[model samples]
Target: MTQRLRFRTSIVLSCFVATNALAHEGHDHPHEAASAPQQMVATAAGPEANSFVADGVTYQWKHRPDLGLQPEAMVAAAKPGLHNNADEDPETGEVVTVVANYGLVKLDQQMKSWSLVDDQDPHFAGGMNSHGMDCFTIDGEVYYASASTNTQEVVVSKRGKVIARLESPKGTEFDNPGVNAYYKSGGRFVPCDVVWVPTAKRLLVVTGYSNGDFAISARRVDGAWKWDGVAFGGRIQQGGPFLTGHGIELKITEDGIETVQIASRGHGRLYGFTPNGAMINLNATEGQYYAQLHNAARPCNLDFQGDLTFVPLLDSLPSTNGVAPVMVLKNFESTGSLIPAEFDDLQFMRHMHGLKTVRRDRKLFAITLSWRNGGENGQGKLNDGQIAIFEAVATQ
Candidate 1:
């Protein structure tokens, strides 16, 4: 059954929503109650069938429910979904995820145990770690890029072995790469997300909200990682960058130009730009498309499969018709509008942040992650979060 979601908008005054969330990278917290793992496969004819319809397609979402835990303590774990990546394990040939605080973890088939391969590398010597991480393979060797909020930098490792730690230029207190001259002052790096471009051999990053929110680029220079340029964003005072540059991904257009799609969480809009910081209109509209479409769902990390786009919301608000922890956008390259026919979720959960798709045996699956205590763990709960897997298929 396809449902139509009414468009609604929710706006926050300050970009300080991320201030308190910067402390969990080093502390040890309590875990959630444990339960037995459930079946991992999805079926079409069983009575346990749970599904939803969107854009003429039927998706049967099955919860591969488990007590998300750290491999060592076996305690319930919560993770800040600052960034996410899903790919096959080179050693075991199974699915794995590069989690924020947990490091590289293999998603077990039986759901009985999760194996942690590498612990996260704290970017600074003694700085507190925050959330955000991504994994990629180069020359058959796995590499991980982790965002350290407290340190305001990124730590790059080779299969868990520390390789590089990226920060602002030496002697500069703030990460003012100086790419744009308009914003005279720069703030803390407070990196939130990072994506590695395999073809170009470079990195694209998005920073936190508070004085951070800048979209910057990085690459290897003279055998060391250095800031290459800025794509967009700066302190909010500049009046031109972004409200909050949170999650970012690379998209290659049909015309052969590679564009960076950024999640401006504070403004509830997705902005696109070229490597040199030229804005690419997501929707071909007379005025700014983002100004017209304000998605209050608080779009977080983005995952793309061909023409289909999956985004998890950091806000608990439901869509026009019902709850949508995750929303799908079809033909995003051509149109960025949230039409009734193009927009549509799992039910009854709040603040999901990570989403990735995997294919096995010709079946498509979506893996999503939720935050612990739904953000700003006031009670100091452990970083365990809810992980859900859904099987999507075309009905037409």
Candidate 2:
């Protein structure tokens, strides 16, 4: 049976425009403008046939075709997982890369290709639409969050097996009041990503919409999983303006302060909050920082290291010839700066999504995905998806 699922991107963008308009009321700044154009410098290409060196970083390219992925299928959000191979290199151990498309797939080191891990898991209850996922290793078991379907619930899995399903703490029924109000459309939680916060001992689930629209909910999972509370636009208190809770990261400062950073897609702003849900005042320079980088039209995932963070800007509305770039920022404290970076001019890198860092042999690497529309029949030549791997080196 050929069942057509409503294009989620269109629905999500529509919600973003409506919610963003409401959130901007009474705010003084002009929300739609970038402070300055991004600055980029070209670098020499790499020596390897499939490699490129830019800004002192060396990257090796791989594609979905290399792994025998169907042209109609798509996958986004590449994250490092435990080495699933026993014959992996002893010195340079292989790291399995997990991607969520129709289901979870892991990079097979031996085959140098991608393989499905949990597409037919019974816990999916017959419907499996895996979106953003994050992993945590506790007690030797790797726990991951797979945003399944439009129910806005996260299926917690360990070792390719479903452990539990988390949804509204209020209950599964839609139309309930309060935080439950947002789930009324039969789309309770449009969760993008989920991360385990060791500092607070809770799981922070990033939802594209919540009660009153978008929000990030904290859930406790000591013996049983339950909602600790929810935060809309960095506030525990509800009834504020709506914001797109797309991507989230839990960061601990040098001085040991725990903070949660979120990519607000609706308003085009990156926000930092304490574990208790108080916004951390960034005090960024006018016309710089979030003011310039926040673009609702091109919001993507965020990855952090120390005080530095990387955010990939995927497809922009109206489209820019299908080019996406990554932004790197430093400090992230009261005072920090954003550095401009460039994306390789790869023909397959259209519509980028998901960003994460990986380490191998003491070298830093980045893995990202790109999606192209496959047309009405879902078989367009350009409608496929690809995965790219890059080795990052700090440039002086």
Candidate 3:
């Protein structure tokens, strides 16, 4: 379901989960909750048919958002209209995705137990110590994750069922030699995005680097999955070549992929790529296809649907010389394909979280966070995450 788009326009670790969420890495500081037995963390809750356990707390499910979310926790990421039931033929090009990695919530929940990569089932495990950042599903085979000592893997399951006992991959595809960027950097990959391309018949994983590098890789789906190699560039300004060069936003296109890379503080650019090959053009704003889409040091979220793009940008109002802060850059660009008239009535949401688009439906959705609380923590006040939907209109 195109995971990356669910994340607001971007991500950068130097700065950067849920119960469903494991603890931060490097720092073994456990959550404020009472310590419990290792295996007890995988608790169970409400309805026997549909339930989830996190950090020793069981959450029951009856009716809520179709995705089953608690009211207070924020909606970290989302993707609308993903029918991941992908079926293609070797002799025929009749493949389509009816399934995808839909909405995901990174809760601060701890795992009842975790196994190091080297110690877990070699054929089945991601190799134990793989920092399991986030979780996703294809056809209902819910599984846990941890990256290999380096950035690698992609474990899938039999469609529609989660086996209580873990099973090694019936087969696996190893990523290219690139993308070994974040081995264990305090659980920053929780918000990372993924793409399963039908044409390429591979899964593209997008992860960040604290050292100013954004790594991406393509894994072949034919027989034994193998990666092409890592391709990286971009980093945070904390002494890196590019300013907030950390690329948090990633999107895959028929020709390649598109992303937003922060170069310097409060500055950014749109990038295009050809799969795991190479960046099609550095900061493609130079190309006639786009104008320089910049941002403030503070990034909100950016989105794309066909050529009609939208970004809930936070920029200074200009009256304070960027010193006191001014306005938000909520932008829309109509690709020559969509009729501008269709979007004339389209409304935009500012101060939002997850933002993603389903190209086939041309529908875009994002989780909205209000500014009422000053964006702070601790208070009866809440960051009630809300979903906003939009239909794109371009200059077709």
Candidate 4:
């Protein structure tokens, strides 16, 4: 049978459980749930070649190498590299997406165009293949939190102009005993992902290499960012030593509870923690500790909407029969999936690294970043990068 056929059969036989639960997670066999066979969408011959409609939402996957930016200004963004993370500003619908070793670019409010902001020439940030961008506002002023992996610092910018660089300054809270060791990278920091918490008034930065969230005071007390110490993590959870800490998102509920969903990429587990570094157990495992969700190897990032979460797997998994790419999890269980070749060809979007969910004008969009997978040329650049936007319009 063809790969798609094989995948469909597997899904029918075992539902959406991509693979057997991790041996440590305690399931020896595949999970069984009642699920109808997925309806396949016929392929089309155009820009949007691969499209599907499920649950009243039309999902179209388009490879975006050229972000519609002017050729001359696409100096860094145009080339094939790790086009990693994409974050949108809710108030304006503007997006700030990043490419490692290239730099950052802005996706216009229209959601279909791109541009280079002033003072953002060259676009490259000197990082290797791991960088994340987040758009947030503080006190009516908007700013972006970009993980500068190369230097292990957080580059904060506004209107495309970098206003401050938050680093572990000497003789500060970061230098405090026991606190400095958890976030040390070449004696600095290796921030993989960053998000600003408005309620707590801090920036939770993932120490990408060290494996945990480091809370940096965004209050700018006396004109400098203060290190609030490690928020949560440091080799002591169910999955210890969460190396390569990659993606994170903030959720503030109506009851005044704030939870940050974190992707421990290295360990292939998802965790949730509060602003004060307390673990929030949403999965209801057994103890006071949080429950870890297992999916794919090096699961890069997460985007939560309502009760579901959108996760992009950085690589394949054997349990998935080697075809897992992107997953939609509801209550920490796979409820929907976008298999490889279902969205595009088997070769394209091979590695799903980053994901973000955006809602604007009554439409819901899922923006995903695929690192180093060239769909057009078959065997293009090894470090090639691409973005796929899947929009789901609301039903009347």
Candidates' C-alpha lDDT: 0.50, 0.45, 0.27, 0.54
**Candidate 1 CA-lDDT value:** 0.50
Name the lDDT of candidate 3: 0.27
Estimated TM-score for each candidate: 0.68, 0.63, 0.41, 0.72
Error of 1 at 367 (Å): 1.4
Which candidate wins on lDDT?
4
Cα lDDT of model 1 by residue, 293-319, tens digit: 223445666766665666665553333
- Count clashes in each candidate, considering only residues at least 3 apart in sequence or on different chains: 7, 3, 59, 4
* Clash list (residue pairs), candidate 2: 152-189, 210-213, 373-383
Model 3 weakest lDDT span, ten residues long: 334-343
Off by over 4 Å in 4: 1-79, 100-103, 119-130, 168-176, 181-188, 211-218, 236-241, 319-324, 339-341, 373-383, 393-396
| Strongest candidate by TM-score | 4
**106, model 1: CA deviation in Å?**
3.0
Estimate, for each residue in 174-263, the C-alpha lDDT of model 2 and write its tens digit: 222344444433434556666677766667766654323444455545656666554434211233323446667666655566666676
Give the per-residue Cα lDDT of candidate 2 at 245. 60
Please give, for residues 174-208, the per-residue lDDT of candidate 3 as tens digits: 23222232322222432133344434444444332
RMSD of 4: 10.9
lDDT score at residue 268, model 3, on the 0-100 scale? 30
Q: Mind sharing the TM-score for model 2?
A: 0.63
